[model samples]
Target: MFKIKSLVFIFLVFYSTINYAQFTDVINSNRPGQSMAAFSVGKTVIQAELGINRIIEKDKDVDYKAAIWNSDLALRYGVFFEQFELIANLEYQNEKFTAPGVDIHEGALKKVLIGAKYLIYDPEKNYEKKPNLYSWKANHKFNWRQFIPAVGIYGGVNANLAKNKFLRGSDIPRDEDFTLKGMILTQNQFGRYTFLTNIILDKFPSQRNSIDYVLTMTRGFNDRVSGFLEIQGFNNEFYKDHFLRTGAAYLVRQNIQVDASVASNFQASPNIVFAGVGASWRFDANYNEVMLRVPKEEKNDGKSKKEKKDKEKKDKEKKKRKDAVENTEFK
Candidate 1:
């Protein structure tokens, strides 16, 4: 136990020592989407987000009612040497009855997730500044969503860590069993309007025949505010459940964001609802310097970053050979 604690401490120290190189997690996110930003959070960046929500449900007879306080947390680390990210998730749930004389009251750690994402493909493409030439309606302004989109693909897994006490009758988290997920992400900009989309597929080991799909769309109002709408459910099976959610988020500069959302299980009994508020903060040893100095799309003349990197490598090699020849003559 002591060794485990010590190792965690060391890992955090290393995480914080990094720099803030990319955007924080998307706003108004109920679940982690597969949309990878075109750029990696530079090696020195560390990001975290926290969500808190209240759930209300009543028995059909209206005698028993339960209110649960659920908290969701996620932390991400950037390994800038490669287009890779490491993330961890922790969830805590507090349950109680608002009504008087109810014996059921419990709150404990419910779930944990540890995963990694590698950017396999990123078309570092940018849109030229253009006007919203709306021809259909008289006053419809154009936006970034009208342009061709840049795509990013990522894959990861969420490990299940449910305490035996937290798993009993009528209580199970959606991420209960070990699940593997793959995501396709894309987005385009219309002026200050950014539309990000994600298509996700989740597979459960215990239920090999079952797969879940989560499709999400995020609209950005500006650099500081954004909103989202989503539809998530099961696909191709005997059982199908569909859910809808909407929310908004406000950014505190480039490193901090606060958001809120409300949702519900449409077919649930007694008409229960879910509402939540959360915030995410990104920090690194060098947030101020990088956030202010470097733009995410560096040199967007249709030349990808990898091409520029190869050019630099060749230039250095040529310089090294020239220097070696001069030294040989001098010797």
Candidate 2:
């Protein structure tokens, strides 16, 4: 039954990619894509995504199946300065573990992540031009992405709240109850393609320390869609592993995107396959300032037009008042 389902899914994935060549995603919602965006979620913006993953392994001696349903909700709040953002995420997890003779189902809140990201540098021409204070509407044409990578730093803590439910039945190795992580993020864009890299260090007081590296390259077909390729590597005091993944994304609106992906072990378990589908939504808070600032060139152009319009309106108002006074005095 699982094999038949897997085959059907594979066909559908191939069909969709062949029909729709465009994709959409933001590093802020890290779903359907492996690379974290170097750009902050911006001031007063929230991002959320939901997806499910299934892993299947079949052998004559052992058969295994695992499924996980997840909800990832995140928000980035710009605080104090425009270059720094406060990040918070909640991941709700539910899983079912199946083996030769036993099936165990578990559901719980997986973990809550809180962190801060600071932009260290942005070399893009548009980013060099700051918008005037009164520009409340987002300027979509401005992008921090350039040939040189934009750099950022992140520090965060993950609080595990699984209640020891799935751990007892699962065979995968995971971090301790609480983990502290530090990451350096970099991203660059060439043409319509974006490349993002992350170097991470994980410290688990109760477990062995680990280090992870992730790289992702995304290609855009047009304004509304994109596709991505990813590579991930992990090293720890006791283990080393690698994986490769590919996926595509679609933007339903300015604030909503949907995605799907497939992955496999890069070294071992050639027959094992992992697949998932998910979507993300982002929206600006109803405030004076928000993410998506205007580009420098665009800002200047807009400023000139606005100033001219204001001058014209003021002159009209003054002439109207003067004319009214003159007519009344003569009468």
- Provide the TM-score for each candidate, comma-separated: 0.60, 0.66
For candidate 2, lDDT tens digit of each residue in 111-170?
677888887865542344445566656544554345577688988887777755655324
* lDDT on C-alpha atoms for all candidate structures: 0.52, 0.60
Give the local distance difference test score of model 2: 0.60
Q: Lowest lDDT 10-mer window, candidate 1?
A: 1-10
Q: Count backbone clashes in candidate 2.
A: 5
Please provide, for model 1 over 52-162, each residue's C-alpha lDDT reduced to its tens digit, 9 standing for 90 to 100. 777776545445567777787777777754356776767777777544554667776666656665554433322233333565443454433356664556566655554
Q: Which runs of model 1 end up more than 4 angstroms from their true locations?
A: 1-40, 58-65, 97-103, 125-149, 164-179, 208-210, 234-239, 287-331
Error of 2 at 295 (Å): 7.2
Q: Give the poorly placed runs of model 2, Cα more than 4 Å off.
A: 1-29, 57-65, 100-102, 125-147, 168-175, 269-272, 285-331
